[model samples]
Target: MGNLDKDILEKIDDWLSSSYDEETRASVQKLIDDQAETELIDSFYKDLEFGTGGLRGIMGVGSNRMNKYTIGKATQGLSNYLIKQFPNQEIKVAVSYDSRNNSQSFGQLVAQVFAANGIKVYLFNELRPTPMLSFAIRHFGCKSGVMLTASHNPKEYNGYKAYWNDGSQLTAPHDKNVIDEVNAIASVKDIRFEGNTQNIIPVGEEIDPIYIEANKALSIHPEAVQAQKDLKIVYSPIHGTGITIVPKMLASWGFENVTVVTEQATPDGNFPTVIYPNPEEEDAMALAKKKGEEIDADLVLATDPDADRVGIAVKNSQGQFQLLNGNQIGSLLIYYVLSAKSDLKQLGNNPYIVKTIVTSNLQADIANHYHVAHYETLTGFKYIGELMTKLGDSAQYLAGGEESYGYLVGDLVRDKDAPNSCAFLAEMTAYFKSKGKTVYEVLLDIYQEFGCYQEKLISLTKKGKAGAEEIQAMMAGLRQNLPTTLGGIEVKEIRDYELSQTTDMKTGRKSEITLPKSDVLQFITVDGDVISARPSGTEPKIKFYCSVKGTLHDKSDYLSLQNTLEEKVDRMMKDIVG
Candidate 1:
């Protein structure tokens, strides 16, 4: 503690003397007395700034933490921004939280802040999914909304995701503008802490049926789902908000043999079943997969804490249950929607699909096969949502997703909708099953049509301040020393997203990239393989996305080609990162 900088000491002292509660002050004092220098500095070094995911951080008592004061200050800042954005009108916001520690309390505090600022607040009576919160904002026609959950992060963390009236998360100008308002608050005294009870409306189950019905309408093949109504489906909420509505939504979708993973059906912030609540991880989906095997289920679905992301396990050609990666699941969903629409001759005018730049290009190929348009955005669902909003009623949005288990079916909810995706995914499985085929066999068939593509994601986490600096240095090094080849293949071109240009290695020709500028770099080999590198917006890590493709002319050749592709991805990753 004595080694702490003078400014840090001042910040700590201010917390002790300010209107901070006794418990918070005593916790800071204990850190000082215990000579916890690292913890103190880590806790007081800086405020948690908004990123692609809004305000998120470890839950504790500090400016850098996701505590009451921080959440309150953020909400107040949002209130100020909303007032300025829509002047002289009654400002309204929908508020909800996930099943995380202190999530409900933080949500209540946010609602109170908005209410105290003379804004109308529609607060959920209990914990709910982030997608539902997004839907509520649009359905109620509110000015904005906020969801309190750390997403798939560890239990020690909590976060706030602010959304606009379109039900999408904040984008440019608004995101930074809200932060500017937050930075203007010099003290906790500046925040409107007092609540206007009348403005704070407690909303309950009345909105549930409306949201469920909207999701039910996303089904494209209702007749097929009805035919295979007993499609042995297993679901696990991963101890998050999905339990609130996912099961009911499945029932609404006409799935009769749905088995909710009994061990993890409840919404608990502790997330005791798995180390990480994210369905993207294999461990998190273990229970669901086990139940799928025991019950001989056709599909297994697990949603993250906020229900924005989902992971599934389907039987492979070997009759063994395997957890499909985000790219696989996303491709399956895209193929299902496009193929169905094409067969039904219902390919709406200007129908299009969207995916992140880091996702597999197989989606683009599938969309092309059906003569549907496909677009790519930066690696965040917010950007996808922004594009959907930008397109509006002009273009029909079929589906969109990222490689992180986040996916969306219809345009109704502007975020990745787990329950909706589950319904659609289950329908996909059932559709193929009705044709005497499994989803896995259908996936192989897809590879047969469009060349087989395998993708790999490697994330190197760098935690704390020093780790952050290390990540920055790593990115700099990557940019400075551009590789000329990968996996023994000549690098044909380089696409530097930060510079918003693509440079051809052979001719040194340059072309401007149209998407928003981001600190990402891509290497395209002469053989059409692609590898991208970018730092994560929400967490302290840098990630590399490698995709390699090969032709699969026969079903029996699937495993052989996939194995070779896996090796190719491994070599490419080693060459890029090492």
Candidate 2:
């Protein structure tokens, strides 16, 4: 450990002298004795800051890692925040954990710290989905909540997602304030790891019934699901927490012919079946698609590790199983919701739809077809939740979704709930089947009614410290040298969300954008194509979202039109980067 600073060296020494296990101490000692400069530097570089996604890192023993000490400090900070927020009342908080490595232990640590601070804690008895934690916070009338999960990250990671009483993740002043408290806790000694056993409550069946009943209430077409009760649906959880309740929820929705992918059904943190447990990953859904093909199922749905995001596969025009991208699924869900509500004459004139700025604009097209309002917020489910809170009383929120496969059916819960989405998606498939059409056919019909909108997401990951700097520089370069055109089309409007302004290149006219400032840039072409560039908040990567649209005159031309749109997206990306 040559050239190691006194502070880092002393921190390691303190861990060695503290109550940390012997194995962790021995690993630190071995690194010190071997003079492993790189390992020591990486381990002791800096404390892992509570990011937008809360504390997420590889499970290990270090200031920058996710371990008992870090989790404890975070919980203590949250407990402090809760106390400050609710000074007079008796504060209670709900806690849940996913099926990740160390998730349960970390959850218990949180509950213990909260209980030690004289706060009531309702901790889930075992592994549970993240959305249920969100739901429980509102249902149990808690002041705050914490979910122990790394979301769709790999097995080496774990996380803590802090929530307010609104059932959404912290935002604005609260998020920064909680971070300040966590940062103020400079030492593990500041954390209270012991608890009054009476204050820590383990919750399971008592709350399960409530969550399932609420999810069932989100069903837009129970009669449709009842009619198509035997609709063949293949489901998988990708070895995460979804399997616990998703199948049961489907059965309750009257879908009796659901097939669970046995290989990926069990909850294992190792995620032995796939490299990434994220439903966005094709490898994770390969088995489900295989089962779909064998059984000729109507739809194949899989949720992410925490069950917050759901991805589905539908048979295309050729009767081959094809995965619908996040944008496609978002459009279909929005289309069905809006169309069904309009058909039933249940839509209020003040009804509105919410979607993240990064999501497909096809939703906007559909919303316009029904004369419903639509609003776009920053790139987070929390912002959508905030809007729902803001407009809950005056304007009705029909539905909202993001480009990342997260959707909210109603305002019952404040987060993207896969359990509810899974049931609703199954109902959508059945509804189309009742109308003598496949889900793919409904999607095509929507496209034919609107235009054929195709979207592509390209994420370029820049890992580690140096990669972070590189990404920053790239964003700066784009802002400095804004492109005048893309894909041979004139860049008519440039929407710079950071500066909260839209500039017309030709007229040199600038106007204000009213949404919250984010590091996203959108270039709209004269031919009605959109290209957006944004950097990831939680991870070290930058993503570019490209959208191109055209008309599909017939179902036979779907594949050819899709290919053209793909080419348009590719050319646009190249022009922007080049």
Which pairs, if any, clash in model 1? Answer: none
Q: How close is candidate 1 to the true structure, as a TM-score?
A: 0.98
Regions of candidate 2 where Cα sits further than 4 Å from its true position: 1-23, 33-36
**Highest-scoring model, TM-score:** 1
Clashing pairs in 2: 1-35
The alpha-carbon deviation from the true structure for residue 57 of candidate 2, after best TM-score superposition, in angstroms, is: 1.7
Question: Pick by lDDT: which candidate is best?
Answer: 1
lDDT of 1 by residue, 1-578 (tens): 46678878888989998589899999999988888888888888887776645798889877888898999999888898999989999988999999999999999999889999999999999988899999999988899999998899888889999999899999887888988888898899899988899998888999888999988877888988999999999999999999989988989989999999988988888999998898978899999999999999999999999998999999988789999999999999999999998999988989999999889999999999899999999988999999999999999999989999989987988999988898899999989998999998888888899889999889898877777899999989999999999989999999999999999999999999998889999999999999999998877789999999999988898888889999999999999988
| Model 1 spans with C-alpha error above 4 angstroms | none
Using all chains and alpha carbons, the TM-scores for the candidates as numbered come to: 0.98, 0.96
